[model samples]
Target: MEIRQHEWLSASPHEGFEQMRLKSRPKEPSPSLTRVGANFYSSVKQQDYSASVWLRRKDKLEHSQQKCIVIFALVCCFAILVALIFSAVDIMGEDEDGLSEKNCQNKCRIALVENIPEGLNYSENAPFHLSLFQGWMNLLNMAKKSVDIVSSHWDLNHSHPSACQMKELGVIFYNCSCLVLDLQRIFALYSSLKFKNRVPLTWSKRLYGVYDNEKKLQLQLNETKSQAFVSNSPKLFCPKNRSFDIDAIY
Candidate 1:
């Protein structure tokens, strides 16, 4: 009798199939889940997110503390490097000012090895630039013992010029003036001046009479008369060495 009652209690397929199927199907979701924040939600909420989460923020300038610490570390390293450099310089010389004093008191390397570039900008502040041939000649003349060449390239003869092939460069005047004027501009008379004078100091004027072009260095005391006898000084471009002098004249 008990076994028959247990079989009826259990929903055996033969006993009550339709009634058991209806019980298994859900009528609706639980009220606690569908009500919203208690358990389940269809979409995310702003309040549910943590403060640490972020989107774009790639520039990172907002983190002032990290940037300040990095900058402070760099400044400390630079200060340390500067200190080491000064210490090394101090070790090189016995006294603090010894290195600087030696540099000021001496003139080294009378010989020159020049490397002037081709197609150089004409409107430079330089007095003038020599052609490649003139610079080579000058180097030969100045260097008796040894020549020290400092050059980015060795194509002086091929690239820029040998003797300034371009007539418009005014480079011939630049070279020839230096050669001739260095001779004409120098004299023993200038040695007695209280302030020492150097080469490229003065421009000279030569005057000759029309008696078959007789050559002489004549002295005329009158300033007014002297002006008429001498040719008007050549264009300032030919002789101007100092930028301030060129600027003032122009």
Candidate 2:
């Protein structure tokens, strides 16, 4: 009965049963060799190929690589060899006491260079300040090369004030901008406010300690009220006071 029903489905296009059909496998499951085309491990070699030719091939490939590397190195060496030869020839040919040659040929020997700023020491013993000047003079006396100079502002002398007559010189000197001007203004204000007479004489020589060991001088100040004495050097003389102005020529 079952064979008869199945036979009818084969005769017809659709199977006789609803939503059901027999699936036909052409062959049953079985193990087979995978055919990835032969490599040494996978397939047997013919006798003509011989036992282990791969190692010899690998060695040949490495030898070719090493030969290529050597060729490349020789090419690099050749590339720089001409430049090295030229440099060596030039160095050997050069009569280098080049500095001495330059000095002699140019006839200008700038012997020493010092970065001495203006008014180096001119304080208590103002003569010490001109040591740079003295050294320069001595150098000039012995080996007189017209001195090299790099001055931005004009009149680079300070033994006397700057020699330029301009009112507003750049950066360094300005006639309106004087250090003494501030001091003058301050003194003027102090005098106008009558601070000198008005400030009480509270200070005396009562402070006592041995400040000077050699002279046996005592550090006595602001102790006694009546014995204080101030210096009387700067007496302001009328319009003549303008001589202190940095702009004053003479």
Candidate 3:
């Protein structure tokens, strides 16, 4: 017809060239969608290698529990420094045996007596044949009964003539019996020698007759009443104003 109708409008089958040949068609996959995309890319590479081996085994179990708490704090500071070096070597071995037993008890309590000579020489002013006035005239020639004489300074011209010759030699050689003489320290040495004019008037009437003989020997020992007199008669005499013959009181 007109050249066969212009070749049927130039092969009128051109629908935008068959959609540009199925948009440059190269797609050919379909073996059941290529086996579901190769099993979803091998299960996402085995879940990224099991999350990097579970974060390297949780960082090697927290570095082995911080090396067992720093080896139990260095074994408790080496057992408290070996118990303070054995308690400072047992307190320096008991202070060296208590300083060698206090230096042998201070060299056995050292002593030595005879080296006296230092001053007032003449062998220290002589006088010493067992003298404290010859041991008080050998305890007033070993008196048997009584001879008390409490003195304060009864130096009536040198200890009242050796205390009236030791009370008349303890009543004629130890037949003593009694001779008390306290007189209140000789009336305080006659009131300090009557205030130092050195009293006289017969020494103030012999210190008022020794204060009236110590008030009549304390009223004859409160009115004598005697008894107890066991005696192996070395002249068993008890009657001298007996009560309990208070040998010496004033």
Candidate 4:
């Protein structure tokens, strides 16, 4: 009896208890060195990747700003270049116009007439009237196309009556245009009966009359009236009875 009981007690065949003992034991399995190293490396790689991304973004921003600044500078330079070019062209055009006018003046021919009679003051000496008349006749003969005469006291000269003949000759023979800037008083006399008494047969057929309108004539007459007594000068005259058919050429 003793021998049989002691065999089971000394070596109990319980595999479950051994398994439970192994499972319940304090297991202090430290993490693998390789695994920890891999984790640390991954974290560093993630940090490096994030830093590189930030640097790339910053570089892109800087590059865009530089491009904008360069573009602006180029535009400004182009504008300045265009302005300078236009200015140069305008200056060259003005210079060309001025040179053309100077050349025209230089090409003009001049005539020199000698043997001018001495002591021939037409204003004071009545004996020089023939010379003055001859000189004016010569000038009128020289005109081929047109003549312009400006006179303040045309009626005072006795030789001015010959001017009508010259004007008729210029208009009929040479088909020339003649313009006379006669004073208002002298013009009135020429248009009135005084002209017929002075020259009965020498009035020009192609003669044209031009004058200011009636309103302007009235105002000028008023001004003349106000100043006539103070100066005692020639009285102004407006063509009251003349025709208004011609165009206003004043």
Flag clash pairs in model 1: none
Tens digits of per-residue lDDT, candidate 1, 1-250, equal: 9999788777576556777778887898878767866434433544344332443243365676689999999999999988666633434432222323223212122222234455556666755544446656765786556544322356656545553444433221112211222222222123223244443343322111111112211222222112111111223312322122233344
Candidate 4, residues 18-135, lDDT tens digits: the string is: 8888999998656797789889999999999999999999999999999999999999999998866663343443121132212322111212222224442345543222234454
Clashes of each: 0, 5, 0, 0
Q: Which stretches of candidate 1 lie over 4 Å from their true place?
A: 1-21, 30-33, 37-48, 52-64, 87-250
Once model 2 is optimally superposed onto the true structure by TM-score, how far is the C-alpha of residue 15 displaced, in angstroms?
A: 71
Give me the candidate number with maximum lDDT. 4
Error (Å) of candidate 2 at residue 214 is 55
lDDT of 2 at 51: 50
Supply candidate 1's per-residue lDDT for 104: 28
lDDT of 3: 0.40
Regions of candidate 2 where Cα sits further than 4 Å from its true position: 1-53, 78-85, 91-250
Superposed on all Cα atoms, the candidates' RMSDs to the truth, in angstroms, are: 22.0, 27.8, 29.8, 21.6
* TM value for model 2: 0.20
lDDT of 4: 0.42
Q: Cα lDDT of model 1 overall? A: 0.38
TM-score of model 4 vs. true structure? 0.29
Of 1 and 4, the candidate ranking higher by lDDT: 4
